[model samples]
Target: MALVTTTEMFKKAYDGGYAIGAFNVNNMEIVQGITEACKEENSPVILQVSKGARSYASHTYLMKLVEAAVMDCPDIPIALHLDHGPDFETCKSCIDGGFTSVMIDASSRPFEENIEITKQVVDYAHKYGVVVEAELGTLAGIEDDVVVSAEDSSYTRPEEVEEFVRRTGCDSLAIAIGTSHGAFKFKPGTKPQLRFDVLRECEKKLPGFPIVLHGASSVPQEYVHMINTYGGAMKDAIGVPEDQLREAARSAVCKINIDSDLRLAMTGSVRKHLVECPADFDPRQYLKPARANIKELVRHKIVNVLGCSGKAL
Candidate 1:
């Protein structure tokens, strides 16, 4: 009926052995596409807003767009989340702005500093009845407001997780287990794999706690081929394996972030349309198909990756 927190969602997912899909949103069409898929599949979803999204589209517009989605699909549970929040103020602002959850990503800082900043956000978010997700290990990827070089990428320290969670008091923890950010997740002739042993260790330490995976998009090759065929160049843009992500979801990973795949799908579809119809001047015609492409991507994630379908009202 209204914005809900990931608290219940993650608990159910953990108990049921399925992860929740948290899709990033930037505009109306993207929001509509993600929610549409969730509604069709009877799944609860997290619509995440990034700092770049807020700067590009304005906070008010994004907030109202989510509100409209709630009105459109009253049967499905949706949570508006602030993804990759840079600091305490940004997390606090989103909590006060009607976001159900916010992520404080201080993973790039020193371990103690990360805990300090995340704890600050947790304290502020709890006051507004909002949930907080914090990152412990730094992940290398190119996302809005989050960019780490591959050379700097490192796995989360297993021993520090218990202390980090205990100190921060965060609702969920995102760990870096060999999954990098962006479309170029892997290079050519290399098999993309996850560090499952590391993940299992984290699960053992924080039993029953909701684990999160950042930059876990299974960059579909079809979309890449489409983009390339339509005058785009994205060489060797490999991502996490869908089967591995499914395995993570069935384990302790309660939330898997997916942004690059959606962008690739939308861009590929739009490019194909424009190339086919060069005389088409109306934006709606191309955007409509792009919206459909994104919606299809969400639906596939729900049924294939996240086993949360039919778990929602």
Candidate 2:
């Protein structure tokens, strides 16, 4: 089939008590690994591209890579999305460039300004048959070009969601509940808990509407250990507990964003492969394992965490 919008996927996820995985894609290996897993698991996926990813890998290359994935995995539904779009121009470019969905993240701005900016993008995107996702609260930590400190981050106000959605006309809303960007989501020696109270309130307000959670990667400690064993020193790299994410999926959270996990899986695999086989200088030799690791990680996520496995069929 062709690339689809998140509308139908989110609807199914909401009804099925699951969430669609929105994985970030920057290169061919990443795209291939994610799609292959989704295809095997029979789960729909949202392959998203960020502004920084567009800068690192040209937009055209990413588009063609996704296009190829569509051809390679024709059975499952796939949505090409612009993740964390900074402005209307970026969102417009993706909407016009064949992306099925786009996210306009204006959460850092004042509420009124955020609504205005999101509305502008929503107006333009809906005209092109593209769906728009908007963020209501800023997330902490670093993800590509998105950087917000812990102190600056705030939980999404449940009260503001109704008006924001009404005014912006976005297809989905990303809320910051405790999930932060990157691997170091919480400080060491602290229990990371998502504010389900806040989430519940939002659900009460926006019933039957699709909600999204950014910075939702559960940074598997196995990957962290693998990286450290292979000459890396990433300490205290904790993420949202898988159980908490599973609970959210059973609620109104219809989409969950995961990027750090993919990066950790690939980086750790490449590090281990190169360190063990120093004589192997070929790119494929190292990236082959990295790609496999990513595929396994995605598969685990589909079946265990997101609970969307076999939904595509």
lDDT of 1 at 256: 97
Looking at candidate 2, what is the lDDT of residue 11?
93
**Total colliding residue pairs, candidate 1:** 1
After the best TM-score superposition of candidate 2, give how far the Cα of residue 141 lies from its true spot, in angstroms. 0.5
Clashes of 2: 0
* Each candidate: RMSD: 0.7, 0.6
In the range 199-271, model 1's lDDT, one tens digit per residue, is: 9999999999999999999999999999999999998899999999999999999999999999999999999
Going through the candidates in the order shown, the clash numbers are 1, 0
Which tens-of-lDDT digit does each residue in 1-313 have in candidate 2? 9999999999999999999999999999999999999989999999999999999999999999999999999999999999999998999888888999999999999999999999999999988899999999889999988999988999999999999999999999999899999999998999999999999999999999999999999999999999999999999999999999999999999999999999999999999998999999999999998999999999999999999999995
lDDT of each: 0.94, 0.95
Pull out the clashing pairs in model 1: 141-181
lDDT of 1: 0.94
The regions of model 1 sitting more than 4 angstroms off are: none
